[model samples]
Target: MTKCLGLVAVLAALGFATQASANQDVQTLASDPANWAIQSGDYSGHRYSKLDQINASNVGDLRVAWTFSTGVLRGHEGGPLVIGDVMYLVTPFPNVVMALDLAHEQKILWKYQPKQDPFAAAVMCCDTVDRGVQYAEGKILVHTADTSLIALDAKTGMEIWKVKEDDPKNGASGTGAPLVVKDKVIVGVSGGEFGVRCYITAYDLNSGHRVWRAYSMGPDADMLIDPDKTTSLGKPVGKDSSLKTWNGDQWKIGGGPVWGYMAFDPALNLVYYGSGNPSTWNPVQRAGPGGKRIDQKWSQTIFARDADTGIAKWVYQMTPFDEWDYDGVNEPILTDLDIDGVKRKALTHFDRNGFGYTLDRVTGELLVAEKFEPDVNWATKVVTDKSDPQYGRPLINKKFSPFETGTDDVTKGICPSSMGAKNQQPAAYSPLTSLFYVPVTRLCMDMEAFKVSYQVGQPYVGATLTMFPAPGENGNTGAFIAWDGAKGKTVWSKPERFAVWSGALTTAGGIVFYGTLEGYLKAVDQKTGKELFKFKTPSGIVGNPMTYMHDGKQYVAVLSGVGGWAGIGLAAGLTDPEDGSGAVGGFASLSSYTGLGGTLTVFALP
Candidate 1:
């Protein structure tokens, strides 16, 4: 049951070897704009397609082509994977994978239902939404809600191999998508709020053999940190970086969850990912300078590791001594840009700390950091070394710091609330316009930190927060903005009544597509941010949008449901007026607009 080695042998004995097709290769995935071969649409994490069949010039004529209801309604967060003429979709909770024949009016070719444990529902920190699945070597790789990593045949719904990746009993689950690199299938664990010391593991794609595992905490050996070699900002981390930063083996339970997206550069042979916040939001309990340090080292940090060996190559801490739970787990989007005339390989990320960063992906050097949201007050600005100028660090304004409220006191009037200017939703980058399309919410929070004791299988969170929109924002809750990453500024923004919770999709057609929390799917001009088209769906959308070419026509598709931390109060009808914090009451307005829905909607030109 726990990543069985013999099960793979049995599968191999049954002639379950992966079948490779010409289009399944990595080169085809990088160049083919008609097929979404991998999650994030070809690994650059651009979420942009080159198919210009649905251009902005005639976008107003777009119409719904077909729809499929998942039947089980809940929060849906990820989009589908389209390969050849088949589109693969994964649902929430039960973690069902359905193969839709695109050429035949979206016929359901096959469906795979794994044996999922019901207890996983209680362990998930957010709604029961699986990000998505990956397709490689003729196999469909899925990470279930119950911590299981499975591979199924693409042509059929046959199970090839299954491995238990996380322990739900220990407050660990798997909601993230699997990333396949060549013959290795990489997956990360979730549950930072449960005091889970997270990790990333790789398995053989052909046979489910566990390769190497790397932890986010513990000693240097466990973290795979070669201090003398692992550099950050052009300097070495020395030795025992992870252990020296913790107090008395506290690193064992120190939370640094990996619940978000990851990117890889085959040329650099490094995989990029960001670690989540430390356990127990109460800084009084988790903060300790064990060795000569003054705070936790790696919590809320970004790491670059050798893809094959799982060894740390470079790391950069975004929030040192994190007191506000601004998770550094946002997607590290990789791209190349011309900065001040020099073209450099950059990793663009919209951090929860309210800053959009452009870093040198090769050496982990910070290039530019600026606010994407105007209401950010947790930090004055992101500054760099006085001598080097390139070694940037956040100049946290203590006047607005959450710690100013005292150890056991409540902090009020913090801008860009605990949900952050952005959360788990991913942004997109278009090579045609060279602009990053970002989905963000504008809000502030009132937080109160309390002491908490660590207990297995129980919540380790020690803070309660009440979130509401920022002051004087004209009652607008969210906006989809086109960001100029090179200039570190916003190009244009489209305001919405609710937070834009869905991922964006930009096409060569000069159109950007996104969904709103109030259930409206809209398309706008990629250049001017002018509304080109809008349609009301059945429910709020938290999933990402995707596009594919089938029958020589481009189709846009997205999953819609009314569930996530943002809409939890609505979907569950949780009207806890006297809740510990006023968060439930503050967000109760969402229910009035939209409720629960789980359906896959596809649109195309008639």
Candidate 2:
């Protein structure tokens, strides 16, 4: 008995029960296609895996290996983390964490469930959707809907540390995943509609102590902007960049939430993320000059900050004086591309504003920008000239500018609904083909601007929108397209009956995988855009797909659920009219296809 006890202690000390060591050289394993260690698969946010065992030739033989019901009836938007013999899965709302032993008939290792406030659900703008959790240094990190950042022992599922990052009572909730960059666990909040002053906070991975805090809208100090040092368009942000942009104390209620995934550059030591739109979609109430004011300095912009210290490196506003709710919260993918015979380090982003931008990652230089879809009439192009460096201004169609249109009531037939062309769903980059596969919506809306006053923690939006399919698109509402970011061109596109609401996954097997609002997990040939395989999932899929190898076999997994802004009206059973709050009448078609559900499905070549 004494010898057995001593052996057990030694095993615990060695972290044998955990099965996977987060201490493993992360940089090495992260790049490995056989292992999925990070949320976006790797720091680059490419969402591309190098595994070819499940290549295009044999993809048609794929079959379901297993499926697990999360038992949480909400949208699931992120994939699982498979490390060695164990897999970690996180569900919505209650934020339950489950560990599965993959080696033995999917044995349940342990589960960690948190007791959460039910009120948080009511405050969430959309159905509670948790992007995912992170694992590092023998701990699993998760951001809860009730505004808590928690760390759990990977082996025992015991709580290691928990910290309150946001207050749900004040209309702030957390749905974005926490990113672990070395010793820092970075998190952000979601409340653009709730009027909560949002910020991104980083905590020490070991102690859970706050290291730095950066607000999305505030003075230079609170925003961590250095007047002479922080810059955008190769120019300094100047004194009080964020403060000068707003009227009075409006910046306090300004809505610039960080509710999406972030990408990191280890070599540059910088992390990049985009902020949400300004408060009250009606820009008339927010005041400020229309175009080229630089006052909307930080909101609706892409920020580059020092990963270690949270100091601003540079920024680029995708939408200036955001009249449309075009939040720049999509994932910014990093890659190297050859443009005009020169290899350039490129950061490609697909904005909700219907434009695909490719910029120099290191210097924040705008290289190429183009409308990704033909229905994008709001902005003709992005203007980055030296004299008028309105990142996305000068090109915003004057006819669609809600502020310029003199009509007090409704500006009819605006292409690309307030939801923009894409939401939080991530695109994929395939190094093998040098193309990006994007899932985008072809939705347009008729919007009416109104007057509203801000009240703390209450919905401050001042707009009524009615959405519908873009005209002249053959009644199709979405498409999956292959883009050449280096040249700002679309290679090929395949239309879908509904919005393509899934994060894209590309593989060395020459296949691109994604999910649909109608419950189909599909794989298309990476080079030819031909449908190779698809499986009907249990529910609509708004989640990302990931690939990993266990026991020498490649496996693909994805979260299947339906509850984003696109389907919120249906999932929540709201009685909105044909032209009401969320345009539930516009999205009524989704009800015929799939309802709310939460399931994790895995597939492998049989």
Query: In order, what lDDT does every prediction score?
Result: 0.83, 0.85
TM-score of each: 0.93, 0.93
TM-score of 1: 0.93
Taking the candidates one at a time, how many backbone clashes does each contain?
Answer: 0, 1
Give every collision pair in model 1.
none
Q: Model 1: per-residue lDDT, tens digit, 1-606?
A: 645878866765654532221123754664688888767876668888899999888888989889899877878998899989888889988899999887787789999999977998888886788999988878999999888999999999899999998788899988889888767888888888888888888899888899888888777788888989998777898888777777776777888888788887766767888888888787767656532223577878888988788898898888777778888888888999999899999999998888999888989988888999989988888875437553477776776555556557878878887677888889999888999999988878877888888999899988888777888778888999999888899999888888788989989999999999988889999889999998888899999989988879888988999787787776556778324234465566888888899988989999
TM-score for predicted model 2 compared with the true structure: 0.93
RMSD after CA superposition, every candidate: 6.9, 6.9
